[model samples]
Target chain A: MSHMFRLLETGFNPAVFNMGLDEALLRSVAQGESHPTLRFYGWKPPAVSIGYFQGLHEEIDTDACAAQGVDIVRRITGGGAVFHHYEVTYSIVVPLAHPLARENILDSYRLFLGGIIKGLATLGIPSEFSPINDISTGGKKISGNAQTRKLGCILQHGTILLDVEVDQMFSLLKVPLEKARGKLIADIKSRVTSVKHCLPSAGSEPFESLFSTTVGALEKGFAKSLDLDLQRSEPTLKELEIAAELAAGKFASAAWTALR
Target chain B: MKLELIGKPEGCKLLRLTIEIDATAGLSAMALIQSISIRGDFFAIPEEEFDALERALAGVALGKLGLEFSKLARERGLQCAGISGEGLDEIVHRHLATLNERN
Candidate 1:
């Protein structure tokens, strides 16, 4: 049997709203108010999002981020910090009772990551799932994901890098002094890659073109990989209202961002 | 003296351990520890429980830090991703041993 999912493409949104929407969707699905959903969106003004367990002061340079006009928010999921620029971020929410939802964390990642692998293949990039939560091509990471189960649903969100900006990223993120050498940065450059790098013809294209192409490919990827019947739609009034409240009270607040 | 150590165990996220120890005392002794803070991009769920583990670790003897951490994880039913109590133990033990060799 094919699963029906709500497909939401919300374009570029601020960090607070983006995180808020994800949490709202997770809660709605858990309460049976919404269908299983797959949302594709981008960050406006760029942003840095840290994991739920991470300490903001230790992971991010606040003054540098503010000076650069970058936003910072903490994710509800658990994983490493990510610089959200030149990327198409995706979030999927499914009930815990879904057959695709596995009990073991690593196994769940492997199952969910297959859609991404298929999506990358559509763009002529052959990728494989690197255990825990990463998708890589030629052994370099192109997508990083994080997951958490909350409100009776599994919420997994990740980014598919459309471009690479290593120097800018390192500037915003803090590295331990010992690992701040040139070699570490060089190693990261070699280890992290982008879709533009994989497809040279599209590398220099406009942002809209790149975004549409990746979004289209990913939609088909999920449909084919998971046998999903995707219904294009917008968020409900209730969801939007909840998202607004969450953005103001939880995601945008200093207390939640600084909570380690 | 204050010491900070970072380690990235295989198949795990980065881990940082900060400790303050008495300079005049032997490195492995129980009384040398003043404070400890463990921070990283690791996941230990029922997330709030991690604070308990971190608090339990404070003032612990250096030699038994790993054992204590492992024991606490078991007691709290910590299911981890990107980290393990034993892996943490190894990093702490190795870091302390390195300091001992240096001093």
Candidate 2:
């Protein structure tokens, strides 16, 4: 008997909907309601998701989010605020006893980051996995990841930058104004690079094209590394229902928004 | 009365502290004073010296004794600064006032 892996490429869903789907998939996997899966998703409305331990009032400008119609949500995992835009996000859920699960947290991050590194290589972007789970190009961060484990399963998700509005991000975040001024802000800008920044001559690839290319590369890399075929599929009915429930009860709630 | 230092020794230019209210108020009634700036004109010091300084300062309570130690650091040419965090002073004072409630 061989393990089955499914690749769900749900492109450009609303932030709440995508978070709901990830939770739903994790639940189904834990309950044995669905097979272990890898899901690639994107945000349509463009939002900032803070880590579970992060304080919304401390990390985000709620007024700015509301005024811009950006959905503010908390992730199940732990990390700082991630501005999700012009990026490809991946979520992987696997049983706790799986080989990948036996590895230490950093080891597991490296394993998944390996696939991402390979994917970026295919796009002519030579990348390296930095300590503490960030992918960088020439010392500038291009991606960030976070993970959570529950009920015999682990869900890891990460973001790859294609293009980002650095100035807008600085404005919307709650970082100290002094930190965002002059040299400090310029230092941060220098340390964070986008794919568009890397490929100035190409005039930035279309989002759809970038999505397809990156997903195809990731699927191929994972298949090669795991020695398994990644069958493309959609969420089962039960998974969809569970995701809807999580979205309504948790991801879309004020309690969750205000949680630290 | 004693104080416990809790923070990384490096990357901490000024020590920010929080004094939580608890029943063991008198047992931990020390004001925390941090180095405003490390003096001696050395970029880094020996780990053993740093650790010794930390251990020596661990349980010193606030008062004349604490002020005397700060003066000594200045005389020894060590630069340091400190400030309390939000609600820390209020919490500490509240705990001290309620010491009678703790039997």
Candidate 3:
């Protein structure tokens, strides 16, 4: 059976709503209620999302988050903490029966990440897929991806850094003094570079423009690679309701956040 | 059995560990010993102690070490399971070897 691809771009939503949408899409696809979908979203007021296995108390300063009105969320996937600022986040949901979905986790990462690598390449940035799940330029990570498989559906989501505040990110996380003393922090700083830093000479492309270009490139890549016609559509009322329910029940709840 | 100290003042850490007891002790008994207390300053604690604790717990048969570690970390006021249960022993042993090499 031929698969249909739909791209839904929900620009700059609050953290709660964005997470809700991801869960909603995952459920919809899993239940055969919706076709395979790719979503591009951003966080308004900004936030930090930690992996499911992470500890918020240890990985994040709750006081700082509250003071800054930054929402703290936990994704269903596993990975390190990521500060969502000046970046474009993308999520792809596919039924497990899909040919691409049958691949192993790392293979799935490569499949989805191909779009991201191509996206960056189109913008004159030379990026390559690093082992596990990062897209980097000259050893500096510009994108990190994570995934969750449930109910025969696969959901992969990740961030593309447009500009990064390394200091702010460092301050928000807990780094042991000993590890901080060595080249660890320096190593991380050296290894992770943002698109803004890479394009310092571009003179004047706003973050939104860059994000749009990246998303456009990804859409084109998916269409060509999957051999499918793509459509951009708004979420159905049922999907929006499901997302809100998921946000209230899972993503935005203390029970989910406090689960270790 | 091995005992090690880690972390620094204010965040100092302590780990009371027992590991690789004879198989006669049974997996549960070895697990109980591996479940030894761990608490102290975050900085004063030696890396070896953490490695030892992870290895000892990971050695427990039947994969009960994950649940035990989870309970132990909570009691010790630590957040998150530092060690993963997937390939528990192998992963822990690999991590310990790495720490040993670094030290």
Candidate 4:
């Protein structure tokens, strides 16, 4: 049996709204007000999103972020801080009772990540699921994901790396071991990979061209891998309202961002 | 490609233990925890409970951290992911032990 899912290609938005929409989708799916959803989006002016349990002051350099016009927000999921740029981020929401949902955290991650693996295959990059929650190729991480169960739904979100700027990222973050900052940056450069690096033809194509092509491939890959019947659609008015409210109240507020 | 690194929890936001011990006392005196802060990207459900726990950890004896953390967490019914009480115990003790050596 194939499951039907709502597909949303919401273009670039601010950090707070991006997170608000994800939570909105989760709430709607949990309440049976909306179908299971797959939303794709990007961040405007870029942003650094810390994990639910992360200390904002520890993970992000607020002065740098503010000076550079970058947004700082916290995710509802648990994982490391991620710099949102040069990638197509996706979020999937499914009912907890769905057969696709697994009770064990690791087991659940394996099931959801298959769609990404298949998607990457379409891009001509062979990748492996690095346990807990990462997609790796050539022993370097190409994608990282985070997950949390809330309101009777499993919400998992991750990014497919399209490009990377290791030096820029390190500038905005607090290096735990200050003395090893140089070594850590070099290590990350070696360990992290992007779509532009994997595809030979991407060098010739403009960034937009590669972005759209990758999105197309992922659509097919997810459909084939999960046997999903994806229905293209727009965010519901109710969802938008909820997202707006959440953005202003929860995600955008100083209190939530500094919760840790 | 067979990669032997079995990923259980990849990219786990690290939660490091930072403690302030009474520097005047020697190791044999059982160094007390003057202050403690566990910061990182680990999740504790009902975030409020975890914040309270961090505050409560102040003045706790270093030796009792592991057992006490588990007890307090259990009592509060706080569920945690990406971190453990036992793990915090080892990190704090090891770090403090090094300081003891230097003293």
On TM-score, the leading prediction is 1
Worst lDDT 10-window in candidate 3 chain B:
B8-17
Off by over 4 Å in 2: A1-3, A176-186, B1-19, B23-103
Q: What would the per-residue lDDT of candidate 2 be over residues A119-168, giving only the tens digit for each residue?
A: 77777788998856689998788988877666768788888887878887
Kindly report which residue stretches of model 1 are placed more than 4 angstroms away from their true locations once superposed: A177-186, B1-3, B19-36, B56-60
Ranking by TM-score: 1, 4, 3, 2
Which whole-number lDDT from 0 to 100 does residue A159 have in model 1?
Answer: 97
Q: What is the C-alpha lDDT profile of model 4 across A1-260, one tens digit per residue? A: 88999999999999999999999999999999999998888899799998887779878999989988889999988777898888889999999898788877777778888888999899899998987688999988899998888777899999998988888888898766532342355555587888988887786777667778888888887788888999999999999999999999999998999986
Q: Candidate 2 clashing pairs?
A: B35-B80, B35-B81, B36-B80, B36-B81
Tens digit of lDDT per residue, candidate 1, span A1-260? 99999999988999999999999999999999999999999999899999988779889999999999999999887788899989999999999898877877788888888898999999999999987789999978999999888777889999999998999998999876444342255565577899998998986799789988999999988888988999999989899899999999999999999986
- Tell me which residue pairs clash in candidate 1: none
Candidate 1 C-alpha error for residue A247, in Å: 1.3
Clashes of 3: 18
Worst 10 residues of 3 chain A by lDDT: A175-184
Cα lDDT over the full model 3: 0.67
- Ranked by TM-score, the better of candidates 1 and 3 is 1
Best by DockQ: 1
Query: After aligning candidate 2 to the native by TM-score, how far in Å is the CA of B35 from where it should be?
Result: 27
Enumerate the candidates' DockQ scores in order. Answer: 0.47, 0.04, 0.07, 0.27
Residue A146 error, candidate 4, Å: 0.9
